[model samples]
Target chain A: MSERTGVIHDIGYRPYTGPREGRWGIVAGLLRHGALSTFGFGRSARSKVLPFGLLVVTLVPAIVFVGIISFVGMDSELLNYAGYQQVTAAFVSLFVAAQAPVLFTRDLRSGAISLYLARPLGPAAFALVRWASLVLAILAFVVTPLVVMFVGGLGAGAEVRDELPRFLVALAGALLLAVLLATVGATAASLTMRRGLAIGGTIVVLIFGLGATAILQEIGREQGVEDAAAWLGLISPFVLVDAVQHGLGDAASSFETPPDNPTTAALMLLIALAAAAAALLLLVRRYRTRGSR
Target chain B: MTVIQTRVLTKRYGGSKVAALDSLSIDVGEGVTGVVGANGAGKSTLIKILLGLLSPTSGDATVLGHDIRTEGEAIRTAVGYMPEHDCLPPDMRAIDFVVHMGRVSGLPPAAARERAADVLRHVGLAEERYRLMGGYSTGMKQRAKLAQALVHDPRLVMLDEPTNGLDPAAREDMLALVRRIGHDFGIPVLVTSHLLGELERISDHVVVLDAGHLLRSEATTAFTADTGHVLVEVLGEDAQSRMGQALAARGVAWQPRGQLLEIDPADAPPDALRDIVRDLAAELGLGLVRIQPQTGRLEDVFREEVPA
Candidate 1:
């Protein structure tokens, strides 16, 4: 056999010559990607069905209400800002229940959490950014209709100066509702890797809590324990948000009165905030351990 | 230079009586180092601890000068890891998954995209880069996993069972790629396998683990060095007996080893022994076919060192 020499060819494997934006860059990229995923952007058309369908369902009522008020004139009985969340609470709840799994459970099931944790970002930052993404998406879902109503009421020649303060209060209530619902939904979804289980758990927690509390309050009312019945509203997330709205003097039109006194309203607000805080803690703790293990 | 160092590393899983890893210490340097062990031998546990994904029950380790306990993130940033299990997200396209991983490893957007493409091509997956990972075959998936690990240009890479599910042809291809990663690219590679002899051809050094205990650690050449015994083959009826009789008549120390005569060159230099064998074969009218030294193998080392 003749002697032979090997030839070297350049395959163009270049070293990275650019800046590596450390932890915050990773967090930002994950946050942006997660937010887009929540609304089904950058995914197949089939993924858009539930989130967009719920969104359109939520917006149609606002559009029709605006059209009616535009033609029928601004009566005080028209759908007010504070009553918007109460009217659409079910749609919002279903929206969160369905979409929260898209944000939390999918990663766990797919083992994508390992990829995320392998980066410069820690587990706490990963959880926080994922939670923030859902919060912003749900916040948009909750606030969009309210903004439309405020603009519609003004376009219908309702006095802007008088409606403005109530609009601001409604906006605050919607923000609070969005945060609390998001916290609860994400925490529930984080508990399991199965999307079906996560959705069922979230619905049972929110809807069952509402149903159980409503029954207890009715019994309290029949027994003439007015104070106890008022406090029972704090157990359900929806009733608690409504109570907060009432405390802020922006009670939904369906409520005959605000929660009997300021004490019940204050307790409801504190309890909702505390529950949300606890859920947030649980989410962070879960990711911290699960991501590493 | 040492790329990985562990001192008295021990790990006990929750509620488990036996430690997964028990007082294991190892130092690995640059080049291809193969970690060989059986199933449930703490290979995955050791990799996880080195990556700082799991804390050791006691003791400590360092990867590329960063403490595994305190600077896990820093260590992760510098060392690329391909896990043993199927951890890829099925929904993502290979390009997107690899680019996102590059981003997560701290590369900027444009650089990440560029590097992802480069690494994909390097791993010989350029044709399937655009396809979703769910549609990939086992070989394709392994290549894609390898692509993501190399996208960030890490100084050290830990590949766990890269050829676990490949056919013989694909296993050869994967082993070649691993050899290229260590030799051509000049990057340190720490690859793990359960098959003892599979890594004998590529690894510069080999470390064997049995039941989480360090069985042996040595250079590949050392493990497979010549055993100083020459096997002689002859062409004739009853060739073995003829060769043994002829060699014994010449005062050569010889024994029968299967079909060949084993020659021990006692009190004679290698050259003088070869001359004596040649002269004896000619005088005895025996056709000498071959004479070659026996070499040790990684499997032999494992069999001798690890207790059944």
Candidate 2:
């Protein structure tokens, strides 16, 4: 065995005099690895189970709806581009919660992050790259089913003019949802080292934020506070993105009393953008103070 | 070239009065330089500060000509650090982890994989590189850690207690690898160990630290040079005392240590001392077993009284 596999070209510790891609390469490398790891690509078989299972589970609804709508020529608004994700947000949230720790918490918990920070990549860049990776991963989860739906709808005889525009709008909402969920998931995972806790915390924060915001919006409408109810949409990422879509008149509202007007929608989109920026800043600071120094 | 130069580097955690690394000022040159100290003697603190992973309280240092304060990332880019603690993720394969580390240190993807294989083989982790590191023995894990450090082909490497949990045979294997990294591979190595003997066998220079203070920093040859003492063992009744008396008559300083007499040839040439001892042994009717010169040890640095 040794003879067959012996190192014939053991050139012995040659110093790399070639060109380095520098810090950009480092960022790109980690970003790719983090994204793949979220869905357990490039990892052990056991790790692939949960992520791929959740992914298949999420895509099932899109496939079933598309199959029925295509063959029967029955059109339902529920199978619309943005409406599909709005309905299946639970599985999407579950997928992010289960996988965020794979990228964010494992290194911090195992002290493997010190190895990463030992490079030229600073803490701010490290956190940002990781956050970006999650955004891409979550985008994959939300985009796949929508793409399937759109293709299936077109093949099932939907008009390109009507469906294409709606598909683009849904794609935009998916991107927004991706960024918002990535921010929330990465922040929650970075808070603690415990894997189960990180997963639990992310799911709770997302679901509770939506539930609490809905209650507040309900209270605001009951008290006849229209502006406060629209603003309260900012508290939950699900409602905020949904409210934006509704206000733009692209997709139907997921919430009761969504105040479906262009003015409130514009305000909600601005609040979402501002909230995403603030969350990114907080995540970077969290990593910095942890001495990713 | 000087690999590391620190000036009054000090580190204190939180509101604690005692510093982890107190006023440490040292220069590490090329080849293997061993940093020796007990646990909490600031060996780890010094490595961390030099790597730019920790901020020193009130001093400055330069690694490979980059100032630690302003050019920490530049310094980190040029140096590879193997932390003393457990840094490996259990579920990852050794090859994957090392390749990832190479990429993190800025190597291109394809090169990272190639260099990862090379370094893992160099560290004697070639065959088992496919296994998850969690299943590895302490020896294999340490080798994996060392492989990751070398994967980037770093200009200088700081290994904090690489022999921490190795068995005797494994420790020998590790020291030999460290020696090759410094001597053959031509990468300047700063390896640390609490055991002086291990470092003495491999390091070219030795820096001793005790309780956050610099005890001594000098060449290994200086620490382990000939002590001007000749050991004499005689086989006869009262042969040890007789040899001692004869050596004293010849104006030699004699100290007995368990059936062997160490005679210092004060101002006498080694050959002259050997001739005198030969004649004295014959005249005293003692059978001289052997005469051997004694070399000092790095351990004696700790045995000596601390200087003010």
Candidate 3:
């Protein structure tokens, strides 16, 4: 036999006399991994199938929307950021519902959060950082296509002057939607340690909220209750955000009767902020009391 | 140095009348100190309180000079914890998970990876470190958990049942690893066990807890040191009286109990007393059953406290 070609050295436990990065280092590490795990990185190949598939599903429509504007130069309703989100809401909701538990439930289920809390990061900060990572990932899902459509349309000869304002409005809507979706996801997922249950719960909130409100608003309008239908616009996340943008005079409302004054926009904004804050508080409490142990 | 100090720390689950940890105090110093107790003895609760995973209902504690209440984050930064339950993410490789935990313990990425590898090797998982942890054995999983705790090179490590569910050989290996951490590396270790026998050999100090109360906290020697007594048993119809009277004739102080004699072995050399007892029994044509020194075991410490 030849002499040994490999050696496994027992370096023993050496004092880590090196620099300790403390809180921000933990934050950065968790955030980076948390965001990546949303897209199924650092996990199994089987885990990658869903998030990557959702990204492609989300991207294909974005590519086609830009293609239609470029080839036909059609004055399409699906030309703006909020409009893009409106069209892709189902796919984006599916993505968030399916993947949010990847970040939220797996850690809680495995009792890994206790180890995390055993670090310098507190339970509240842990929840927030995890919330931020999902926000980043969902933003990527919403923005990747927005960027594609913007550049692709510009390449197809759409004027920047005509498109820039609409682009900015959609950008703001995407941020708000991402934040709302992430908060909902964290709230739903952290409530249970079961991944399937968490995913189903998030789907119910994101999709059920949008579906129920949209259907009710349509029925209310057909029943000649236009006031009620418009008020129903304040119910779901996407329509509520659309109402806000419309109130701000940037986009038309998805509702039959759009908000005519800025007061409704301000009121809706306040409600949205309050709701998001409540959901975030739930996440923090869950981490502190249930998830950490 | 006292690495952990607690005073009147208490934890009570709301509905349960019995407090999990009821007004307990202990000062653990710079070596392997074993927290020995039976099931539901609040060992895990104590660990959680120290790690700041659960807040105490009352009183105060400090870990590495940081208050457990206000400075939980600082204590967490300086201390590593190996939880009793499963905490490893099964889908990830050992190296990845340990590195991730190292970062969570506040080390930067490169340092985290470097120390992760070193600690994994130290835990004897170097060969299998690249495999997903779900595929590993229980011993491997335990070592992986230990590796994450040591990866940050914490000032102290609080391991909850480190030898739990291991076969005897594996338990021996883990205890040795724990001793090396406290002794060779000079890092303080607070290890818990349900069995006193396992920790008795490795721990420099043993703290016995019974039902949310401290039974005793003392050096290992205080628990195991020999007392100045020896027991001798002789076999015969009237063995007890014959041996006692024979030892008295030989000027050895002795007390007769059924089938045995308790000798103080006072003044005379212990070996001499043993020889005389043997010679006396033989001359009396009696069967010498046994001669033994009565050294205190850590278990005896518990038995003494709860004598029936």
lDDT of 2 at B188: 97
Which runs of model 3 end up more than 4 angstroms from their true locations?
Answer: A1-11, A73-78, A291-293, B15-17, B231-269, B280-292
Best by TM-score: 3
**Per-residue lDDT of A1-293 in model 3, one digit per residue for the tens?**
88988998755557888888867867988899999988878888898898888888888887887888877777645566667777778888889888888888888777787788787887889889999999999999888988888888788777889778888888888888898889888888888889889888888877888888888877887898866676676667778778877787468665566566888777877888898998898778878886335
lDDT, model 1, position B117: 89
lDDT of 1 by residue, B185-291 (tens): 88899999998778899899998888888888889999889989888888777767877877788788888877888888877898998888888778778888998
TM-score of 2: 0.90
Q: For candidate 1, give the lDDT of residue A195.
A: 91
Better of 1 and 3 by TM-score: 3
DockQ of each: 0.52, 0.56, 0.65
Q: What is the DockQ of candidate 1?
A: 0.52
lDDT of 2 by residue, B12-87 (tens): 8888899888888999999999999889899988887787767789998999999887888898888888888788
How much is A263 displaced in model 1, in angstroms? 3.8
**Chain B, candidate 1: TM-score:** 0.90
Q: Which candidate's DockQ is highest? A: 3
Error of 3 at A270 (Å): 1.3
